[model samples]
Target: MAPLSHYLVLSGILFTIGVMGVLVRRNAIVVFMSIEIMLNAVNISLIAFDRYLGQHDGQIFSFMVMAVAAAEVSVGLAIVIAMFRNKPTINLDEFNLMKW
Candidate 1:
């Protein structure tokens, strides 16, 4: 079995990559995917700790986080679609309609 440290390391890497994606990408959809990546990283850590500590709390929190992530995805996608319909592009830089 993999060590807890290994799981944590992997989770950190995934979270870093997700942060980089969110920071470097200009497309709204790509940024949204990056956010999901970050959420999954948290889930990985939650499951890892749950395993290491022999408790169900972490697992329960992980489930809650998954639910929240799902809701976020649904609402975020709806907003993105609306923005696309209004302006025909999903570029964050171009989404300056509210700045006027």
Candidate 2:
């Protein structure tokens, strides 16, 4: 099996990319995807550490994260769809639903 450091490095790279995507992208969908990538990166690290330590705690926490991510996706997409129906664009800058 690969070393823990290798998995950590890969997770770090993926997290960095996800952060860049969230910061640089303008589209809501892309932002959501970036968020997913970030979550997955965290999951990878959690599982890697769990394996390295011969424990299941990290794996169980990762599962909880996945569940939360799934719930977030459902609600987030619903909001996005409603906003798109009202504005016809998914650009982050164009969304000011709370503006008066």
Candidate 3:
């Protein structure tokens, strides 16, 4: 079996990559994907710790997070579609619908 430290390191790497994607990407869709990646990273860590400690709480929490992520994706996609209808682009810099 793989060590818990190894799992934690992988999770940390995934989270860092997600953060970089969110920070460096300019497209709204890409940024949204990055956010999802970050969420998955957290889930990975949660599962890893749950396995290491032989507890069900972390697994349960991860499921809750996944549900929340799903809802976020649904609402976020709807907003993105609406924004695209108003504007012709999905570029984050071009979204000024709320700007004064």
Q: 17-76, model 1: which lDDT tens digit per residue?
A: 999999999999999999999999999999999999999999999999999999999999
Give the lowest summed-lDDT range of ten residues in model 3.
91-100
Q: lDDT tens string, model 3, 4-74?
A: 99989999999999999999999999999999999999999999999999999999999999999999999
Show where candidate 2 strays beyond 4 Å.
96-100
Tell me the tens digit of each residue's lDDT in model 2 across 1-100: 9999999999999999999999999999999999999999999999999999999999999999999999999999999999888889999997665977
- TM-score per candidate, in order? 0.94, 0.94, 0.94
Report the number of the highest-lDDT candidate. Answer: 2
Ranking by lDDT: 2, 1, 3
* Model 3 error, position 100 (Å): 9.2
The runs of at least 3 residues in candidate 3 whose Cα sits more than 4 Å from the true structure, single-residue gaps closed, are 96-100
Query: 67, model 1: CA deviation in Å?
Result: 0.8
What lDDT would each prediction earn against the true structure?
Answer: 0.95, 0.97, 0.93
* Regions of candidate 1 where Cα sits further than 4 Å from its true position: 97-100
